[model samples]
Target: AQSVTQLDSHVSVSEGTPVLLRCNYSSSYSPSLFWYVQHPNKGLQLLLKYTSAATLVKGINGFEAEFKKSETSFHLTKPSAHMSDAAEYFCVVSDGSTDKLIFGTGTRLQVFP
Candidate 1:
């Protein structure tokens, strides 16, 4: 049982508010999780990752996620929202089952002026 589910399909925020994206996952073994962002017409870029090293991990663009093993969750958050931060985000899970990363449906963030 290795999979991920992004709770929000879309999130809208005003230009200076906080941002939160929820994700839940299940894994048979110890797993590694990742968050990635993709801008329009651009490839996906790594935001942050957690690999059994730390429960709280920080990524680029003021993004961070906490790996809660008991709850099987890895939710991403940002201190403040920016118009440029509008993009699609994906929660990923991988346990060496394949060379590819298992991606969630994705959550699209919309920032308004």
Candidate 2:
């Protein structure tokens, strides 16, 4: 079975400051990982993904995550954050063999000026 744990339930950042959301994963097999973001009343959006190709995966809106097998981590990071970046972030894990996905509790980002 594959699972993911979002270390932080909420994260707050000032505009223009860096943002970091921590996540740890456990998988029986090589897992496919993803970071999804959802704004208030908006649908989920794919921020980035890791599919065993590269350790460092880049995605839309200047967000990126690095797969660290040694650390069992896939932490999301951005050099700077914007007000628009505030949202609920989820860390998802898939076994790559099934459609089933395990999602973390999510981390809500609050961006303030």
Candidate 3:
């Protein structure tokens, strides 16, 4: 079985500050990891993915995560937060062979000016 846990349900940041969102996971086999961002009332956009490839993965909008096998953690980070960055984020995991995906509850990012 594979599952993901998002440590925070919400994150608030001021414009131009850094952002961090924590996540943890458990999987029987090697897993595929992903981070997705959803803007207000919009569909999820793929932020990044880890396919047993790179430990340090970079994504769009200056977001990135490191896959830590020891801690089973993959935390998202951004150097600076933008007002437009206010949205919901999800940490996701997929079994190496399945089409189904498991999603974190969600983290709502509030950006203040």
Candidate 4:
């Protein structure tokens, strides 16, 4: 089976501080991993993706994630957190079957000044 679990449902961070959102996944075969960010009332934008090519993947908005097969984790991180970074993020996984993507419930990022 393939699934994704976001460790935190909500994360609070100060402006300009580093941000970290944890995620874990399980898959039967080599899987494709993705991070997506969604602003209020807006569609999801692809932050980054891991397709069995690279372990360290970089995305938009100064975000990045490392795919660790042994740990079964793909945690996202950023050096500086911005007010605009305050939004919902979803860790996604592809079952290696089709284009269908399974999304985690979501993690709300709250940025405080």
Best by lDDT: 2
Residue-level lDDT tens digits of model 4 in 6-57: 9999999999999999999989889999999999999999999999988999
lDDT of each: 0.95, 0.96, 0.94, 0.95
Model 4: per-residue Cα lDDT at residue 79: 97
Cα TM-score per model: 0.96, 0.98, 0.97, 0.97
Ten contiguous residues with the weakest lDDT in model 4: 95-104
Query: Per-residue alpha-carbon lDDT of model 1 for 9-100, expressed as tens digits?
Result: 99999999999999999888788999999999999999999999989999998999999998999999998999999999999999866686
Question: Which candidate do you rate higher for lDDT, 1 or 3?
Answer: 1
Per-residue alpha-carbon lDDT of model 3 for 1-113, expressed as tens digits? Answer: 88999999999999999999999999888988999999978999999999988899999989999999999999999999999889999999997678889999989999999
The residue pairs that clash in candidate 1, if any, are none
Point out the worst 10-residue segment of candidate 3 by lDDT: 93-102
What are the runs in model 1 whose C-alpha is more than 4 Å off? none
Clashes of each: 0, 0, 0, 0
Find the candidate with the highest TM-score and give its number. 2
Give the per-residue Cα lDDT of candidate 1 at 75: 98
Regions more than 4 Å wrong, model 2: none
